[model samples]
Target: MVMKTKLLLIAIILFSTSSFISNRPVTVFMIGDSTMANRSIQNKNNKERGWGMMLAGCLTDRVIVDNHAASGRSTKSFINEKRWERVLDRIQPGDYVFIQFGHNDEKEDPKLHTEPGTTFDDNLRKFVAETRSKGGIPVLFNSMVRRKFYCNENGLYTDSLIDTHGDYLLSPKRIAEEKGVVFIDMNKITHDLVKQMGPEKSKELFMWVGKRKDDTHLNIKGARIVASLAIEEVGKKIPALGKEIRRYDYVVATDGSGEFFTLEEALEMIPLKGKCTVLVRSGQYGPKPPFVNKKIKITEEKGVSWGSSAAHAEKPLKNLDLYLCVGQSNMAGRGKLSPEVMDTLRNVYLLNAEDKFEPAVNPLNRYSTIGKGLGWQQLGPAYGFAKEMATKKHPIGLIVNARGGSSIRSWVKNARQSGGYYNEAVRRTKEAMKYGTLKAIIWHQGEADCHHSEAYREKITQLMTDLRNDLGIPDLPVVVGQIAQWNWTRKPHIPEGTKPFNDMIKEIPAFLPHSACVSSEGLTPLKDETDPHFDAASQIILGRRYAKEVKKLIKK
Candidate 1:
């Protein structure tokens, strides 16, 4: 009897030990670039703290934050200097590594740079392999943007950094995929947040020293915001550590009255039922709004389909796709759509007020569609792409995550490559799929990447490859639109300048696989000179072109 009792005690002890091991604290190790590194005393004395420092405060005691990121280290230099090797030596099982680099990688100087070709990607894979070997998870973040501070005629600060970092941001993402690692695009999130803040207030987030234009590194406040984003990202992949997540929250709304809820109120209201759209109202919602919620639409409207009151007790909706769209003015969907085209796409609903609610004054109805500005709108390309998939049609959902007038660099996940626009598109794509499967990715970019013809092909290829890998679908179909003919050709601006860049775009599709390019060379109307955006007529054609390419890929 005594022996049997001792054996039972031992069994219980072993079980407890196993459980403890399984639920260990998530240790996050950050690597790469000055923006993420521990800034020098002089730098910190000036109130500059890298985003990694502020990120430490967001995690509970259970999560450990160790940042080994260095200042001005490119992919090649990081490896040659054995910085990553030092990181690899310390990594343990169940650990997480967040890598953000690329700013310095694009340097033309061979001593300090890395070509976004095989070398850049190869170094990334090495980091992934070493991390995994130690049973650690690797997360890739594209670089952040440098604040250029350009505004439109209306004084709205348009994010233009995407143009600068387009090619630089693609390398790490492609490497993340080839290495089977997770990626978070910090570049895009920060850019959108800054743009939302507008030019004036956005300056407060960076370390703007004397004559330096310190857009590359974040101050203490900026670091905290970025760290919060990283924490939210990790919570998506590993739910066990969610308790330690102090930065973000997940909520559902049951009132169905189109009323908005603060982050605090939403958290207290748990497990909300019925079909409801989590409304993010039209007012400027900043990064501090506790955006880390799950299964909520974060919308602005009260009525219409997928709105607040649309959800009833009888019908419960499951699985929602939230998209984030960011680009130049075209992505903002300027100009009007013909009534005929609007009818054909009737299933699509914009975030406008109903006739009954605002008969005399429609507050949100001023714009031609919900696609104007950044708001939660119905699935556009994702919906169309899913519709094309008749046989394997999954529960169709989309998150319209986009921003206009931004360059590709604006969206890069790495702080070094901030303001890179494509990175933002990638981040939005990942965010959109959190609720469901991403059938296809539709991209309409090239004006920014066209500037540097020498590296454009490699950059585009890497961007597509990285996007596919980040979403966990390696061979996903990617559809891109060719740059439309601009009216600059009609007027005299520069002679050989535009031709070289425009001509290089024709060769992008040739290098990529399972990718199709839509021709918008002649789609725009002759009269639309002031605005280079596609008219309603052009959008239908463009949408059709996207659909056709998607169909062709699906058949294969």
Candidate 2:
């Protein structure tokens, strides 16, 4: 009996030891660039933190978060600089390593870059292999979308900017699938969330405070939300970690009423109780409707009648300033609208001063405060631009005065003072005054000037100067779209002088002040010798480039 009792005691001790070993804390190591790096003040000892810092706070004690991300490092640089090696040396069996990159890799600079075609993918594979070799689980996350969201006539979220570095996400996803590694699409997740939030309130989830107009990085609140999203994604993809997650409950609120509320109203209604989502129904709200008052999502839906309002927890309302969008044809758009897009534009109201027109007349014509225009089309620049800005939680008012085939010469101040294009643009600018304060002017009209390249530079410069003076906004930002590759002439008959004309147009932004150029050189749609209009993919690229330039201009 004594021997049997001793054996039972030993068995119990061994079982307890095994259980403890199995339940040991799971270490999570984060590796990436400034977007995921620990925020430390290089200028001063500021307490700003990165998304990785907030990640651990969202999980249970069973998970340990250790971020080793640095500023301005691509996948190749991270490895070449031995950053990944340092991370791997500390990793233990059963640990997890989360890799997020692609922001810096997209840089064309040779010194600090990774070519998305080969280097980016190769680096990702190496990270995965090294992690697995050390008995650690390699988890990959696609780069997050910068906080730039625009909507089309149908009011859907356009994927212009998101698609630019698409290979950034695709490479990781492909490797994960091939190697059986865990892949979390932070990009797609963020995109869906932004669409749900609409443009206005989504801005609150980004780094939108003083001196930094960085859409690539997240603020404290933005970091927290991103961390929470990452946690939720991990729980869904990795079953073993599901029970360990503490914040996975997302409450979505949809507005069934066909009429949409301002972003302000939606922000007021979204509760701070838990992870919440607010979907506004498809319909026009007022101009500069408070779309992004906070970190809440404002989405739109069609075909299905959603609920009116959802209440989770009451919170004080936050006020947000409005953003105005102005430009020409590309700004107007040429794509077909989807239900999702229309639903997302619920809060974006067009101040159409012109008479009622077809929703298709100009899907990009969103400036008139009282007139109707083409209401449904795939958005070009505005959809993506507005959606991205709204995601930053800033109030947005788009004052569009773009005319198809319009030239820069037409937009001069005094219609009677100048002939040709100047007179028409000045007249339209006068008509656009009733809409609101013209914050920015987006110009996409260099095609006509290509035919008259000899004097394009001087004419464009004068027009820009006159425009700023006339609007009384000498510092107003003027964003230009570089003419993409187009075949304006008939098949087998290329315009001999078009190339030089286009090349000269590309150099306009270099000479102008307060002006930035969005390159559409590589974004033209594949076509025969006839159709020159950009395709959906190319439009997205153009829009994203515009957003990037705009963000830089707006940065303090």
The lDDT leader among the candidates is 2
- Total backbone collisions for each predicted model: 59, 61
Tens-place lDDT per residue, model 2, 1-556, is: 5566456434433432342268666667889988777764332324345677666545655665667788888887888888787577656667778999988888987756776658888889999889877767778988887777666789786644445466777888877766666789988877776667666677677766677666667765567677788888887766556566654222121111111124445455546765455443333333324443455554433422222221100110122222334334455554433333443342333334442111111244544332123221235676666555543345444555455444555545554433344444444554444433455666776665666776777877887788678666788787877665665543354457357667776676678888787776776542332434465556667766777888788783
TM-score of each: 0.40, 0.40
Q: What is the lDDT of residue 41 in candidate 2?
A: 32
Which run of 10 residues does model 2 get worst, by summed lDDT?
A: 310-319
Q: Model 1, residue 513: what's the lDDT?
A: 75
Instruction: Give the per-residue lDDT digits (tens) of candidate 1, residues 1-556.
Output: 5566456434433432342266554457788888887553322245576777555445554555667778778878888887777567546566678888888888887866776766777777777778877767777888887766666899776655434687767876676555545567777777777777766687788877577667777875676566677667756644544455653223221111111224335544645564343332222111224544555555332221223323311122124222222334444443232212222122222222221111111111122122222111111233333234322223333334444444555444453655444554565455445434556667765555546666656666776687677667787777666656664444355544335655655555567777776667667741244344565456556656677877687678
lDDT of each: 0.53, 0.58
- Regions of model 1 farther than 4 Å from truth: 1-23, 41-44, 151-162, 210-212, 248-556
Task: Kindly report which residue stretches of model 2 are placed more than 4 angstroms away from their true locations once superposed.
Answer: 1-21, 41-48, 151-162, 248-556
